[model samples]
Target: MRRSIGETVILRYWNEGFEVQLKCQVEYIDNRTQMVIVSKQAEVLNIEFRNIYETL
Candidate 1:
């Protein structure tokens, strides 16, 4: 799978914080499987859903 900037990553907002999906937005391409995801609208950044790269 290939993920690029402006691409929406489907993630599940989790608890704890940064553990699972945070319903975050693609902030920037850090590398390949590593990216900066921001919190979803109306929700605070707590956990990360899943850092998965989309199929390109």
Candidate 2:
């Protein structure tokens, strides 16, 4: 499914040697860059679609 702004999502990606899971609210999306901007509490994260293992 496609994600949209204001939606809450769980993102899973590999980091270090493990898979990390983060839950954040979607803030913005850049289709050209295939990037997603999301906020979790006080932190804003930039995520690339290619780095994502899955979205739940």
Candidate 3:
């Protein structure tokens, strides 16, 4: 599926050797780099496309 900025999504990624799920809003997407920037509350995160397990 195609995702855009300002969309809310659920992402599952490996963090500290653990699989964690984060619910955040999309801030930026770089298709060429396959990276996404999302914000959850006051925290901003950078995630890889491959690590995004789902969208909501």
Q: Judged by lDDT, which candidate is best?
A: 2
lDDT, residue 54, candidate 2: 82
1-56 per-residue lDDT for model 2 (tens digits): 25458889888976666788999888988889998888999999988877788888
Candidate ranking under lDDT, highest first, comes to 2, 3, 1
Per-residue lDDT of model 3, residues 1-56, tens digit only: 35457878777787667788887888988889998888999998888888766675
Off by over 4 Å in 1: 12-18, 31-35, 42-56
Prediction 3 TM-score vs. true: 0.72
Residue 44 local lDDT, model 1: 38
State the displacement of the C-alpha of residue 29, model 1, in Å, after optimal TM-score superposition.
Answer: 2.3
TM-score of each: 0.32, 0.78, 0.72
**All candidates' lDDT scores?**
0.43, 0.83, 0.79
lDDT of 1 by residue, 6-34 (tens): 55555544344443433345555444545
Clashes of 1: 8
Question: Which residue pairs come into collision in candidate 1?
Answer: 17-46, 18-47, 20-48, 20-49, 21-48, 21-49, 22-48, 22-49
Q: TM-score for model 2? A: 0.78
Best by TM-score: 2
